[model samples]
Each structure stands twice: as structure tokens, then as C-alpha cells.
Target: MRIELEYNARSIPPADVARSFVPPTPHFGRLLSRNHTLLLGPRGSGKTTLLKMLTARALNSWTHPEAAALTPQVTFNAAFVAADIAWGKQIEAVGSFDFNASRKDAAFVLHTLRAIVHAMREATELAREGRLTPHAKHLAIEITESQEEKLVALVAPNLSVRPALPSLLGLELALEARLDTINSGEDVAPFTVESFPSKISLLISAFNGVTGDSDRRWALLFDELEIAPTRVKTFLLSGIRSFDERIIVKLALAPYMDDAGFERNPISPHPLHDYHTIQLSYPNKDDARNFGEELFARTFERIGVDAPSLDLLFQPPEGGSQLGRRGNQKRQGVPEEFVSLAQKDTSFAQYVTERNLLSPDYRFNENNIAQDIRKVLPIVVARNYYLRRFDGTHAVANRSRKSHGLYAGYPSIVEITEGNPRAILTCVGPMAQDYRQDIERADGFVQVSRSIQTKAIRRVELLLTSLLQVVPLDLGGFDAGKGLLGFVDTIGRAFEDRLLSRPFTTDYVSTFLIDENVSDAVVKAVGMALNAGAIIHVPYPDGGPDTLLRGLRGQRFRLSYALAARYRLLLTLGDRISLSTLLLVMRGVDVGDDQRALF
Candidate 1:
């Protein structure tokens, strides 16, 4: 049966995205917790969808079994407040809202308070509609009325013209109009900074009053903080520190906001300390696999496909081949496969063995030869040839001539997907579409060809590359964009030199260590790449036991199979690269527009 997939979530409205959302495994529990939280992840990692789900759950409309199960764990009456900061238009419209050197903070805080009040009003309306419990309905109304009364009292005495109603919305409109009049040189008292703290205190008190007890809580969910004006975001974050325990603030932030552009100051509250962080992206391989499976299953079900197993969908096409038994033996340290493959070319095995004898570090002992065999055998068996020299050129390497079946199996598809949701969506949609088109053209049931898989994978690579390009990589002092390009180039060269091995049946390209002293910008950029499914981070084997004890850590960044294939950086199995070489290359290489462009 033919199936269609929908992969791009950004084009969908928030409500629709929430309706089809699947909670990522790692952070579902924390997302339901009452503690203040920062949901950090790259675009398309489902941060906005999660926020919408939370908003739906708060209103009791999200009836999915998973969301229902988590409802009992929540301790708060929650409301979602979107920070739609239209800085340019707002600055032009609000004449009296001066962002002067001395009064910027006041303007920011005022704008933020307006958004919160608006959200509180929305929550009150929800309660009136019976979405909330009877007790909550009464409390919401009471708080809304009281907060409106206090706000009116604060702004009424200074107004040249009185508002018709003592409501918060009326006061805001009147204040804007009054500010405009004052900016035209009319003699009226301006909204002062000293009065903002008191007004904000009253609003907070109203929010706290809704709970009526310290044990009860109210959550203010803030979304799109990454898009908020700098002054506005600074004010909001600083104000969060003073919130009482009864009020929880859950913020949705873009990945590496601080590293990308937000300035970090010692005086501001640290995200790690002030709030719990729920990462939306997969942290490891297992998580990626599980998430990928869940997403694949969901998509299949939506398209009326009975995909009971991800393995079935990803199964290799008939006639596709894997490494031979001898290659498997080489993986386990037996050099028979390597010797046999090389022997096909008249004593090449003996020639290499004899050549190794001349070098002090290249002994021809069984252990050393077996290691070499492990590294070289897969390349030979896959390409069906042996390289005579370690030349740094992919053009000369014995790569597969049959491009169609190279990426033809379910296991191989999973490797290409790298457990990334967007990658899965972008890939599966086109593959399914192609499969359907093929069936229609043949006028009967038809199998998806290897060419289709290759095309879909290429499309995913281009999509990822495009996504990565938009992630701002300049972190003030560190040139992360350049560093990342250099790093990828270094891996490409390593693959050409036979220093890193490529996986035939999996998505991992090769792993190389990152130095401890790598700048945080580069580290975060790597993380962004991982979130984009451009790469994956593999911790050192044995968890680098001593690094854990010593509190020293290093990351092994593995190129995503799709990206490696796109760049022609895929290597043979068992090849390896050193950290020193990578660092040297990264420092020396220059990134040009040609290198950055996906096309």
C-alpha cells in the first residue's frame, strides 16, 4: 500500500502541530512537572508543539492517553503567554515607550506585564467556559477583578482623560494613547519606573491569591522567548528570580540562545540554577532510535499503513548484499578476509606485509596485520578491491559502482535517519510518495526501487544542510561557523586517507574526539548540528571511566550517514582519525561560501 508523510511542522499551525505531536522520551516527565523550566532545542525539534500541548492540557482539551496520564502529576493551574515581540513596529507605534539608555528596562517590564495580564484574562475566560474546575473558576474570576481594580487605581490619578472602565485592557489602551499625547508635548505625568514594581507586585499578588495556599500553584507558560526583544527578554528573566514558589514559569527557548546572541552577565540569573532544562533533542543513540521508531510508527498509522515493526519498513530490498563471512571475521581480528581479498591481485598481500616490515611502527606481526586487515578489509570487500597507497583522495578510492543498492535496507534507512524526527519526516514522506507513484505507474503493486531511497536520502541531506545554515554560528568571539565547516572538511580528508571507517549497515560515519578546550560556541554548534541530524555525538567507549572520575569530558562527534554521503566522506569500516589532526585542520582551514552552501 502507498503512504504519504507530512514532515514539515513549521508550516502547520500550532494547534495542528499539537494535535499530531508525539512527546519525546527524555523530557515528558519533566515537562509535566510544576517546577519552572526552559524547554531548549533547535527548530523542528517539537519545542513549540510541546508548548501548545501544555497549553491544551492546561485547558483540559488535550485528551490523548499519554497527556491524560500526565495530568494527575501537574500541581498547577497553567496558562500560556506567547511573547510575540514585534520590536520594529512596537518602537514606531509607542511614542512614549522610550528605550533610552536610562529607561529601557522600564519599557520592557511594562510591555511584559501587559502580556501576562492578557494571558491571565484568557485563563479566566477558559475557566468561565468550565474547562477548569469550579474552585478554579471562582478563583480566576476573583483574581482577574482584583488585579484590574489595582491597575486602574495606579494609572487613574495621572491620566489626562479617564478610561470608561476600570479593566486592565482599557487601562493599557488608555496608557498608550496618553503616552502618545505626552510625546506631543502635552503636560501630563509620564508612567514612571518607580510605579512599575508596585504594579507588578499587585499583579503577582493576584496570581498568588488564585492558589490561596502555598501548597497550590499557578504556572505561566512563556513561548517564543528566542524571538523576544533583547531588553524584554532580559527583563523577564530577571523578574523570574523574584517569583514566589506558587508561580511557575515555563519558557520555550531556541537552542543555544545565549551562545548565538544573548549576552551572559554574572548579575543575571543562570538558566541552570533558576530553572530545570528539558532538552527536546535525543541525547544518545538509543534515545534517537526509540524516538525515530515512535515517529515512524505514528506517520505510518496516519497514512493507513499497518507498520507493526520499523524493522519491516526499513528491511533491505531483495538482492542487496552485506559484508561476507570473511569480512565479519576481520571485524573480530582475523585477517583471512583481508589477505584473501588482497591476494586476488597477484601477491599484493605479501607485498604489503613485507613493506610493513621496513618501518619500526609497522611491524608485520599477526596482531598488527590483523588490525590493518580490520581497517582495510571492509573497504575492499564493499568496493571489491584493494588500494595500493593511502592517498588523500576519494576519487581514487574503490567505492561502490552500484549506487542504487548502496543504501537499500531498513537498517540502512534507520542509519540515514539518525533518529532525528525532521530527518525521518523529510525522508519517509518522499519515499512513500515515490512508492505510491511507482505503483500507480505500473497499474499494480510495486516495490520501491533503490533509486527512490537514494533520491529521498539526498533530499534529506539538502534539507538538513539548509536548516543548519540558518543557525547563527557566530558566538561573539568564537567563529563557530568556520570551525564547524573546518571540522567537517577534516573528517572528509580523514575518510579519503582511510583513517576513519564507514558503516555499511548503519547511519554512523565515523567517530573522532573533540578536545576538552574546545570553545563553548563550537560545542553548542555541534549540538545544533546533532539536533539537525547533521551529526551525532558518541561518548568515548566505557564512558571514558577516568574522565567521569576526574570530571574531564570529551565528545566523539560522528557525521550522520546522510551528511557523510552528501560530502563523499564515508570511509571503510575500522578506519580511525586522531583528535590532534582534527584540531590542527580545524585551526588552519578557511570557510568560504562554496563550502557553506548546500546546493
Candidate 2:
């Protein structure tokens, strides 16, 4: 009856490891040409995760001979440099190291510097080992005098003639590094380092030989790329390109880079343009439905129970009509009940299943959608309004959403990059986590579990946002609630005038004035968000939807305090709210009522 889900990073499978949600680009093998393949996607579209997995797979242990012939494996160690930058400072000092050199001990100093550089880069060691083990807990031995002797002996022949002695021990590192305090936060002093670039070249050369068979000459992953200052970004990009041609680098950028003032980082002969750009799109509606269902089933397993996979749900009948209905005699009502859930469940899975509730053969039109809301009654009606409130950018019906918001700025676009089902699910985990955080930030929310939660004002908003985002052509109006009614004509007018800036367009955005010419399919979807109590609509006891037009600009396009106050009046005015909170009473006052007048 109830389920709980957890985000398990370890369980996430790699996209390149032979999976369905993602496919090796027809041209992925040639990703490392002077022109880099730049993959860009919205948050949770699996861009970063895919990169890590892709790089790993590209360096597979079982090297295919044909693959090797097509593109040579450029073995390189990967490290999250940007992530290091974000961990604050002491860690930043981790990148700093000592390269001491007394003139008499020049050879000895050279070896110590090399060893320290190795130690400084131990972050990649963890990634190399795949997982930590007891053996890796500590470096068994430090650079003793003997080991230093061996290092010097290995390169003795390469040293400059005695007449021209070098001041720095390891000439390679000397060029890029300098010893200085790293500004660590502890009262203790910061670690010093040799800031030379040549040392890295030598180290990468050594690593390339060790893992000669791998794809990335040196796989370096940079997560949280946007957090660094533009200057730092510019510098790092230059560093990777200049010193390491054999190495492959991957960067995890912020979700908003699509809006990343391109003008700021003008695309000229910039190095980043070389990467093959890719954007992560939300899973298709079919994939989303499966992902959601799988998550639900997994949660059930965590609690020591097992149920059907998402595939078990009855498919939406091919036509535009009701596919899953309880009253139908063809199959069990269990499927119908499973497909539809109570609107207020705020958990990640909420009250959703794979069943198709629309009756077969009927054309899906706006009024039909409205009728669906009416049929599902007050529970679905109120929640739909809430779903549209939170996320308004993407279309809501049968589609996956990458970035969500209802601001009327952009048209709905669905472009999917991942083809593997598991990878898609893996990508979604983070986005879902963001939604969960949003729920927590909302006023008076009570997260019951992973799949379910008690709805409050904010949860109601979440419900509405989800609905409005996916369902297109859905606009309506509600005057201060003389009754829970639709503003069909008004929604038509406002939309035609381009009044809805999306999620915040109108308190009764769902009911905004619209022309009757709007598509029926879009209307149906909006009705769903509306029925789910995802939007806020308040019709005056004596007012029409037009009253909302009085407020303009910033004041008009925000959570309506008047509507909230009015909705507040409706809930408390009624009979007791239910176990799962429900708005059963319509907004209005009783006439000719006594002091004991009840809603």
C-alpha cells in the first residue's frame, strides 16, 4: 500500500556499460578529435554521470581490436578538480606540495619533488581503484633518501652538464610551480607547492605508460565547473589543452549554463568550443512513466516486499480516450486504481502507477479533461492547480521535463539524449532530490515517506506546478470562489493576449481567459493539474475572473495573497479536513445562516 525509496549512488549503473537509456553516439568513438564533442543537458539529464561512465567505458579493460584501430585509447587518470575547488581551502592546500631543494642535494631534491607530486594527486588514486580498500589506507613508505637516489639515477643522463647546473631539482616541475602558503583556514600554516606545469606533463607521461591501453590518455573529470570564477575557468581550460593533448577532460557544469550569458564567455576561438556539446533532456513520457514506476517498486522492496514492475501497468489505449477506468468490466479495477492516485501525495512517486484511466475510443478534448477533473472530484481538482504552480516550462502530458518552470517565456521542447533506462533513472535521482528539497522548503510540509507525504499549502503548490508544466493549452480563471468553477472564456482572452507568463501568470492562470479555439488536448492536461489542486483559483463571492486583471506586472504574476487568504477561508470554513488533507468546500459564504452555519 505504501513504499519508500532511497538514492543509492553505488547502485547507479554506467551509461556506457551496455545499457538501454543511452547509446554510444554514432560518432562517439571519434570524440577526441581536435574538435571535442560537447554534451550539454539540463540538470538530472545525466550529462555528468554519463561523461564519467563514458570515459570509463571508452577505456575498457577488454580492448576491442576494431575499437583500438578506429580511435587509440588515450589512458588518463580522472580527478574532480572543480569539486576540489568547492571543498573550501584546507583541501585546496591538498593540491599544494613541497619541492625543497638544497644545492648540494639537487638530485635528492628532484626525487622528493616527483614523489610529492604523486602524493598530491592521490585523489585520482581513489577513482582508479574504483573503490577504497584497506591496502590503500596509507602510502606504505615516504620518499626516503634511498628512493630519491633511485629517481635521480633513472634520469641522471638527462640532467644538464655540470657547467650549467639547474637551480630547481625536477626541471619539468620547476617551470609551473612556486613554494608559498596556500592560505589554508586552520590556525596551522598552509601547505606550499611547486606551481610548475612541466611536472604534470611528466607525471601524465608516466601514467600513460602505466595504463597505456586505456582510452583517455589521462581522464580528468571536473565537476561543478560553474562554481569557479570565469578567470579560473579560462585558466584551467587553457591548462588542460596546453599540457595534456593525450588526456581527456570532462566538466560537470551548472543547470543554468543554458542561460549562462554566452556574451560573457564569447564563443570565438575559445578552447571550450572544441568539446562536443550535449544537453541532457528529461526521459520521454514513456521512459518517465517507467522510471517512476520502477522507483516505486524499488521502494517497496526496501521495506521487504515486492510488487509488479512499471511495465505491468496497462498501456494507455492507442486512441485518445480513457484507457484505464475502474467501472470497465474488461479487466481488474486494480490497474485503474493503480494508474490514478489521490492528487496530494507529495512523495517522489506520489499516488501514481502505470494504469491508463482514460476510456478507450473517446476523443481527448479540453472539456473531457475538465470532465475528468470533475469525475475525479474535489481531490483531483484542487491538486492539479498545485502541480502547475511549481513547474510551468515543460509540457505536462506524456512527456519528460528537463528544466521546469511555468514562466511564459519559452515553448515546450523535449529532446532526449539517453537511451538506457537505468541511466535515465540514475539521472533523474538528482532532479527528484531537488523536488524533495523544494517540498521541505515549503511552509508546513510533512514528508511521510519517500513515495508519499501529507499535503499542506506548499505540497498543494507542488502538485499544481507538475500538472501545468506538462499539460499544454490549459488556461482558465477563477474569481474569488463563489464556487469551484472554470473561467473558460476568460482563460481564452488572457492567453490570446499573451498575459500568462506561465507558473506565476495568474492566481487563476489555469482559468485565465482563453479563446475557445485552443486545442482540446492542451485543455485536458491543464484540467488535470487544475483538478489535482495544483493551481490557485479564487472567484469573488460576487466577482468574475476579470477582477484578477486589476493587478499588473510583478504584483499580478506572483502568489496571490488575496487568493490565498480567500482559499484559507474555504478550508477552515468547512467540515473537518480529511486524513489526507482535502479541500472539500467551495469558496463562498452561506446566506441566511445562523451562528452555527456549517460549510
Per-model C-alpha RMSD: 8.5, 18.3
Question: Compared with the true structure, what per-residue lDDT tens digits does model 1 show for residues 1-599?
Answer: 54545565534544466555776776767787877777766555666566655543332544345754564666555555555433322454566554442244333344545555555555556655665643223234334576567656654554333666777567656645553443344542233443544554555564455434335465666676766555555555566666766677787765434422323566655555665666554434455666677777776556654456655455354433333324434233334434543444333345455546334566555666554554455454443332323223222344342343445555566556655667778877767666656656886444556778778778767776666666566544334565444445445555533322221221223566555545655555565565555654444555421121122126555676666455444322232344444444444543321232110
Position 476, candidate 2: lDDT: 33
Candidate number with greatest TM-score? 1
RMSD of 2: 18.3
Model 2 scores worst on lDDT over the 10 consecutive residues at 406-415
Who wins the lDDT comparison? 1
Query: How do the residues 282-376 of candidate 2 rate in per-residue lDDT, one tens digit apiece?
Result: 21223333334544344334444343432222222122122112222233222322233222232211322221333364444545444443233
lDDT of 2: 0.31
In candidate 2, stretches whose alpha carbon ends up further than 4 angstroms from where it belongs are 1-76, 85-181, 184-199, 209-216, 236-243, 257-273, 283-308, 311-599
TM-scores vs. true structure, each candidate: 0.66, 0.37
